[model samples]
Target chain A: MTPVSESLRAAAGTQRVPVFRARGVSKVYDMGEVKVHALKAVDLDLFQGELLVLLGASGSGKSTLLNILGGLDVPTSGTVVYRDHDLSAADERELTRYRREHVGFVFQFYNLIPSLTARENVELVTDIARAPMPATQALDLVGLADRMDHFPAQLSGGEQQRVAIARAVAKRPDVLLCDEPTGALDLETGKRVLAVLEQVNREVGTTIAIITHNAAIGALGDRVIRMSSGVIVEHVRNERRASLDEIQW
Target chain B: MRALNRKLLRDAWKHRGQMLSIAAVVSVGIMTVLTMRGAYESLSSSQAQYYRDTRFPDVWVRLERAPESLRGRIAAIPGVSAVNTRVTLVATLDVPSVDVPALGYFVSVTDDRGATLSDLHLSAGRFVSPRRRDEVVVSDKFAIANAFVPGDTLRAVINGRQRDLQIVGTAISPEYTYAVPPGAIYPDDQRFGIVWMHRDALGPAYDMAGAFNEVVLTLSPRADTARVVAQLDRLLEPYGGLGAYTRMDQPSHFILAGELNQVRSMGTMIPAVFLTVAAFLLNIVLGRMIATQRTEVAVLKAFGYSDLEVGRHYLQFALVAVLLGALIGIAMGSWLGQSMVGLYGEFFTFPTLRYEFSWILAVLAVGVSALAAAAGALGAVRRAVALPPAEAMRPEPPTSFRPGVFERLGLGRLLPVAGRLILRNVERTPCAASPRPSASAFRSRSWSSGCSCSTACNT
Candidate 1:
């Protein structure tokens, strides 16, 4: 796995040196006659194995930043350097390789194929991944081993989301991006989902960045970013990330 | 590739209605094209039979009178075989209560022999013998149509004078080529009647047989028809001649232009309609399926599948639909062609109308239908396979409806249920006609799957 580098050892829980460094990142949307600045003059850095939470309201550019970091969109003007490689300036094939070797993503709705069983859904990813564990073992890591053969329809909403987590993490990527992972679920289900995310962080030591507006979620992250009107208003560093189960609702 | 084909077949089965509609379109087209060919062939063979049975003479000579020297010269012509002179005139038959329409009777100077001319059919009784005075024979067509038989009585009008005659036998002339009945545009068997009598007997009693109206000859077996006809016409020119008609002069009523061309023209026009319709249906159905499979395409792309691979998957549908249509069309066209031949046997008198098979039609049908199916899939496949892998992998963002907008005018408070329904509807996709909508989560389907390899792989 390209994710295993000696410098990433310090990123466990907290790291000072930047593993993902950005300088003057900007993403502009040209709408026929009007241009909307989705992201502007953003500068940031992220370290390995640290859980960073992005906080913002709708249109605050939190999702935009996450999309760019996950290789889903290109920046209009910027330099995003992940280790020795420049991501923002890379071509489509290069971005694809970066995503496959270093990044994994989880979205709000789970996005599971309804016709496939939970295990098969995760296996869809692991089969193409390099240096990955078996899909069944990955699902077990997410606490969904017993429901491997159950289809998405047969499982509860929380169980399906957990399968999604297994699918993303099965490749053992260095970076995990979650865009509102628990946004669609109820509080109890959300808590269970958060516990799985926390275990993946502690065990796999993946540098996770979750984009959400839930203030309580910030309590569980090593670093917190507050965004408003396409700009980062505040960046707060926590001395310690509270254990997933220890954080109060 | 074989494994992919097998999977493709299963998916096609899952979407049977759509596939069959495409096929039906092609089958209909092939049937139309084939039917034209069949109907024309049937009519042609039928007309040919009519001509042969009538025994139409190649060269005919008619005159008010001819000298003895001229008759001998004509009979001794290089290509002449045998010759017979006859007096023919229109007459009406008088039954007990039925006065039949005008008919033609010939009074021959002598009984026709190979030494003379005897190309007529004697279906039942004997022909007029030499030196016979009162014996007469009526044609089989007249006897059969009028319920006449051997030894039946018949009356003939000789120059507006009634004369009783014996219907000694029945025979068929060798010069009547039409089943529609001689001198009638439509079929009227009751209108054309023929009888035969000795010229010596008719001339003494009726006094009109001495002046012959026509002279017929049976040509030598090896004679050139056109050359003989020209020589005979020149020899008989002083006797008053009009024209000569050979078997080749006749054109089949069904094939006035060209039998093959007629068949082809009909074959082309009809099936084109159904095939076009089938193509349109395929395009629409496939387009809808691709649109619905948008997310799945992204997932597959994320799994390292090239856009070309994904596009080929969609193209399989077009091939399946079109080939199926072609197969069905071939079967239908063949069956209809045979059935049409049988239908024609009722009025036609051919030995048989042979069934001709054309594989070209089958090829054309399949080719056209496949083209249609492939054309239909273009938009869907293009749209699904065009996106960048990353774009495909991400779920579409939810379209948010502002709660304040719904709350305005106190509508949200009054129609809370409706508002909730609208919100839920917006969240769910507009999935309607797609048969295999995303078909479940991304699972790598492989060839030769079994328990040995599947246990660790199912997840």
Candidate 2:
């Protein structure tokens, strides 16, 4: 048995609830002439308020697994349960509602609307959220309070990524899913972004799952799962997670 | 404002040029509609009211010499409410500093104004008095065209003798509102005019001292005009009568009605072309916008915006463009409409011809433009919402290309790089490159939209 399942069993013995439970999940894409198997029978459990790092090389299905857990896509043949909701059985509309109420996603490229200021971009998600943090407060959490009025074009790449982070967290979602959140930044900037994500998870107690190709980023998480060829090969629990300043590329 | 609405405003401002282009097309369409519609209403209504106020004759009969006693007989006919008898003659007018001899229809008016069936609206001067036998009242359009004023003297060949007539006044008559010479399609005011003369002078000049050459009849409201015309023609047949006809056959009214129909048709046809092009341009622009904004759209979807919300956003953008165009059109159309009324006054004489503003037309224009803009945005908006969030968030795979069908037909090697590039783009967006009439935004709209516009005008 993997260390992740073993930790989960230990967690279950302590009566700690999980945020998500996914079983036998597989995704196949039909490209007309050929079938591409993106995800193969994957079973995973995401515990409440814990930081998880999905570490893998490109095309190893880590992002696919994260996407499925976030309800961004449907599995070809599997069951995914989020809290009391059955994500596998949910239609598009139900999934949209689920995402709006419970999920926050941060992408590699900060897809901030160019026409909008940083503050306004965050307000976009908060306006539709059932429960949300104030946009200014969210920006303050991401250390972008002074740069709220600057448009995406006027900000640096690291600042834009911070704004994207603020926009995602402003909704006060229960689960935060980040897919390569610092893929395009310099070493220092990437470290700064990781620090913000770490701070957000610590302060808000929001469950976080970050998928990344950089193996070093895995040291910051409470649990790290290494994936290869659409399956987890290794899972380890950290007794002491490393701080942002102590880590180097 | 909500964040989404703020984004809408800033995005629209960023693409102001495209939005303004769409608005301009809509403005042109509305302007055409309002201008022609305003002109038609002003002309038809003014003429109808003028004819009613003057109690214009419904039927006219012309003969070589009809005895004055025939007036009583015509008045006694069933449905004939009034009969006006007068002597008429066509004379050649010779004005000073003018090389060509102009045609003049000289009709005698009664000294008693109340008894006249076809009355004149004096515009500038007094009517010709009976004592002033050589005085005349010239048609208003003719006077304006020839630059003649009251007290101007004109020489005319009256009954084979040259006579000098003084222009006492300029008058507008419903009978000569759109005066055209006999057998002429359009009015030539410079070469033809109507001169109202005294009965005592005109009868003697034409050598018909006690006989009338023209008879005008006004019938009851429900009178059969054709039957009355046939009866009058037969009764005056022995007196060398040529024929009798109702107002529908009158050259002035015929030409005026034809002109009004033309205005209506032009209003419908021209705008249809402009609006159709506008719709096509809007579609192309929105389609391009969707193509470029796929990432933003995916982000919006990931942020929990539903497909309906995204669709509404684009539709609202399209509507905003349409609204801008409609405002420009309303201003432009109103100005054009008023100016056209002034222009029409120069050709058609009316007592009260003015620009008539129509609120209904304005409303209709706005409604139609809204519908057109919405329709143009529908396909683009749908495509935007149909983008899956997962695939769209990542970089799209590069478009694949194979050696086209032409290569299989052995024609690929003959094509140059530029030709292949163009063909590849054409294959990617087939509508943009095709020669099919409906696919073209500019050229083919002229014919197809013209047909649609004429139909709209008729309705």
Candidate 3:
């Protein structure tokens, strides 16, 4: 076993279960006369209710790993098991059902529909979820209770990102996959958005994997994995998690 | 409403300018279909009712001379129901108000008007009196054209003799619904007229005191019209019979049928052209919308919306526009159809012409428009559904720019940056640049050509 998987297994032994187990995971994108190897035979395990941060540069394939875990994509050659379900073997419809039931996603640019208000955007998840929190409650959890009626265009960047967070958590998903969720905000706003995600991870007891390129933000996670050129270069377990206020850009 | 539906409504409103323009095109197409079809139905029903009320003849035969006793013999033929023999002659008239000499068709009418096959609907005054040989009933259109009231007198040369006839009545007939003179294609009300006289007076004026020159007959509902026509022709052959014909060959009915056929063809063909253009516009607009909303679609799919759900959401956008256009078209078409029927009443002498709104046609118009819009939106909807959420979440790659035809020819360097950018965009979106403008140009050209053709036909 690789050192990262051994550390993950060792971490899971005492306190938690491994929610996602991936083996020999690799992804290749064929762009007509060029084939880009996004991931190279990577192995990973994410523990239940633990916050994990994937730190990488722009082309380091952190987003691809998160997408594969969230059932948004299938690796070129890998086996991914989310609890007991074989995600790599799943078809499109099965993947949709899996995502619907277990996964929530927050995107970098805050992909909240501009036409809908903050509450309505949250309701987009609650409407289709099997067991969901009320949309208003979700917004209140994200610290946007008073701005629930404002459209995305009317809100500031930080507020829109909060609404996106509320939308992702409204469904009460088992895992939240965030791809550069604070990438578009200023340093202070990014810290606030990260604080909301931290709060949600602690309160809801949901497994959260946040992908970012900022090294300082890695101190806020229970575990941090750094990747370079489609390969994991280091895996570290933080002895003490720092609160959002103490973390700086 | 669900959040997705709210988003749909807001999106539609945000693009209201494009949606309303598309709706306008759809409304015009539907309006044409309803107006022409509604007018056709009104004219046909009115003509049928008028013909039924007048007991219009099924067959008419004109001969040099046939004895009055031949009426019974013609009536005894199998399938023949009722026969009336009458004397008809042409007379030259000298109208008091007009400088040009007019032609009059003089037909004999019995004292009991119901005794004949084709009876007139008297619009003013009484029918010709059996006791007054000088009294005549003039055609209503001719009377109105010349300002000839009931008490006016008309001088005519009958059998080379000038005679003064008192106009006792003005009437319209089912047989003369489209009253054009013989050998004329258009109705000239001032130059041609119909004069109805008592049979006793007209028979002697035409040098036929006891015989008649024309025979009109009705037939049984189940009768074979061709067989009866042949029998009548055989019986009148010894009396110098001109070949007999059914009402389908009658000049007035034939002309009216031809006109109705033209209306029907125009109704279908013109709407097809308009709808084709609307569909093309819809394809362009919806395709661009999907292109812009790529990230939104990916987010929805990432939230676990199925491909079908996303596709249905976009399709509802098209349906909303179609519904709005259909409602507007129905209202406008109904009103225009009524006005068209009223206009027809002035030329074709229908006692009553009412525009009948057909619910089936309205439903069909909406259905057809929906189909067209759906067809137009299919490619866009498919593109939205087929997009992989993972790929769509990322920003689209920049379009690969290369030297275009003008640049390769060395002329692009002469233009400014803005012009070069425009040329580049046009080159990148060749379909967007070419088809729409060319289609609209072709539409306008064909429209003008059609207008000029109709104007020429009218003159």
Best by DockQ: 3
Q: State the lDDT of candidate 1 residue by residue for B389-444, as single tens digits.
A: 55665554343334554455456677666444443333232232023324311211
TM-score-best of 1 and 2: 2
Residue range B277-334, candidate 2, lDDT tens digits: 7777677677667767889888888878888988898888888888898899999999
Decreasing lDDT order of the candidates: 3, 2, 1
| Cand. 1 TM to true fold | 0.57
Model 1: CA > 4 A from native: A1-23, A43-52, A79-104, A119-150, A169-176, A198-208, A219-224, A233-241, B1-250, B253-262, B286-334, B341-363, B384-459
TM-score of chain A of 3: 0.97
Q: Candidate order by TM-score, highest to lowest?
A: 3, 2, 1
DockQ of each candidate, alpha-carbon based: 0.11, 0.67, 0.81
Across A129-210, the per-residue lDDT of candidate 2 in tens digits comes to: 9989999999999899999999999999999999999998999889999999999999999998999999889999989999
Q: Residue-wise lDDT of candidate 3 within B259-358, one digit each (tens)?
A: 7888788778877887777776677677767777989999988999989889999988888888878888899989998888888887788777889998
Docking class of 3: high
lDDT of each: 0.67, 0.84, 0.87
Classified by CAPRI criteria, candidate 1 counts as incorrect
| TM-score on alpha carbons, each prediction | 0.57, 0.84, 0.88
Ten-residue region with minimum lDDT total, candidate 3 chain B = B450-459
Q: For model 1 chain B, give the 10-residue run with minimal summed lDDT.
A: B444-453
Top of the candidates by TM-score: 3
DockQ of 2: 0.67
Question: Chain A TM-score per candidate?
Answer: 0.91, 0.95, 0.97
